[model samples]
Target: MTELLNLFIVFAKIGVCTFGGGYAMVPILERELAEKRGWAESTELLDWYAISQAMPGIIAVNVATFFGCKRRGVIGGIVATLGMVFPSFVIILAIAAVLNNFADVPQVKSAFAGIRACVVVMIITTVLRLWKTSVADRPAIAIFVPIFALSAFTGVPLALLIVASGVAGVAIGAVRQGRGK
Candidate 1:
């Protein structure tokens, strides 16, 4: 019961205060879950973040579900997801009521513009942080560079890229193992 409440509160705070979407929430999530609360290790959090991105639904919500389930169980997943989504639901509803008028307001428009800049910075920070951990060795670099280039230049579907990368990783691992044997 206490754990569930804590999960709800923590995720709710994250959802409410975060100005951008899932990518922008990464740094905050890392700070709270990995550093402050010690709910997960930094590497574990990153792994969950990657998996969440590959799965269906919103990345932040999926991450919350993964963390909650790891901490408590299925019920915790439910609680955390609800907590994360509730704020956006309420805020969007409220905004919908006055969005037409609010959209044209100079102050609101300016605030949104500032927020967009901040969100870009937050996303870049998240990318750098993840890269620090992920790009540790030659194999990782070998896989990452070409995939990045292909995705950037050709706009390959992300799912297909991920699948190809996974297959390559497995093949490389198998070759290494065979060599050792």
Candidate 2:
């Protein structure tokens, strides 16, 4: 019960504090859970982030669920998810109640612009870190470049691309192994 409360409080703090959604939450998570709590390393958290993104739900909730389950069990996952969403639920209600009146104010607009800028920087930093770790070899780069291009410039569905890339990577690894090198 005490551990469950602690999990709720921590995830609630993370929920209320994070802006720009899941992508922006990565660095914050790295600092809190990874560096400070020492529950996981930054790279390990990144792996969870990747898996969470691929899951069919909100990434933040998925991440919280992952951490919670890892810590305790299914009940912990439920508690953590509720904690992670509670703040956002209240905040959105409050914002929606007041935002219409101030939506056009120059000050509010400027503040939003600043927030967007910060979010972009956070996202870019995470992406760069992911790239550094993920695209380390020629085979990985070969997979990344075309996938990036297709995702960026073409109408290719990402699920297909991901599947194809997985197959390609496995095939490449098998070929290398067969060559005894």
Candidate 3:
């Protein structure tokens, strides 16, 4: 019970604070769960982030669920997921109730614009940090460049790109392993 409450509080803080979405939440999770609390390592959090992004549903909630399940069981997953989602649900409901009146206000508009800018910066920082660790060799670079370009320019589906990249990585790894034998 105590652990469940702690999980809820930790994820609730994450839920309330994170602005842009899953990518934006990564750094905060790294700092709070990994660096401060020692719940998991930064690399483990990044892996969960990747998995959560690939899976359906909200990334933040997915990561929280994964952590919770890993820590305890189904109940932990439930608590963590609720913790992560509860704040957003309440906040959005409140915002929806009030946004129509304030949506046009210049200050509100400016504040949102500033928030978007910050989200962009946060996403870029997270991607750069992940890239430093995830993309290490030429084969990975080869897979990354065209996928990035296609995702940026073309209308190719991101899921397909991710799967293709995974397949390419597996093939590269297998070939390298065979050569070493």
* TM-score for each model: 0.88, 0.80, 0.85
- Highest lDDT scorer: 1
Better of 1 and 2 by TM-score: 1
Show pairs that collide, candidate 1.
none
Tell me the lDDT of model 1 at 160.
80
Q: In lDDT terms, how accurate is model 2?
A: 0.82
Worst 10 residues of 2 by lDDT: 46-55
Model 2 per-residue lDDT tens digits across residues 23-119? 6788777777877888766667766765765568888999999899888899989998999999989977888988766668999889888988987
lDDT for every model? Answer: 0.85, 0.82, 0.83
lDDT score for candidate 1 against the true structure: 0.85
TM-score of 1: 0.88
**Better candidate number, 1 or 3, judged by TM-score:** 1
Ranking by lDDT: 1, 3, 2
Model 1 residue 127 CA deviation in Å: 2.7
Residue 72 Cα positional deviation in candidate 3, in Å, after optimal superposition: 1.8
lDDT of 1 by residue, 49-168 (tens): 667766788888898999989999999999999999989899788889867576789999899999888878877877788787877889989998998799789968766877788898
Q: What is the lDDT of residue 66 in candidate 1?
A: 94
* Stretches of candidate 2 exceeding 4 Å from the true structure: 96-102
lDDT of 3 by residue, 1-181 (tens): 8989999999999888788777778877877887799988767886676566567887778899889998889899999999989898997788888776767899988998998888788778877876876777889799879988998999997767777877888999999999999
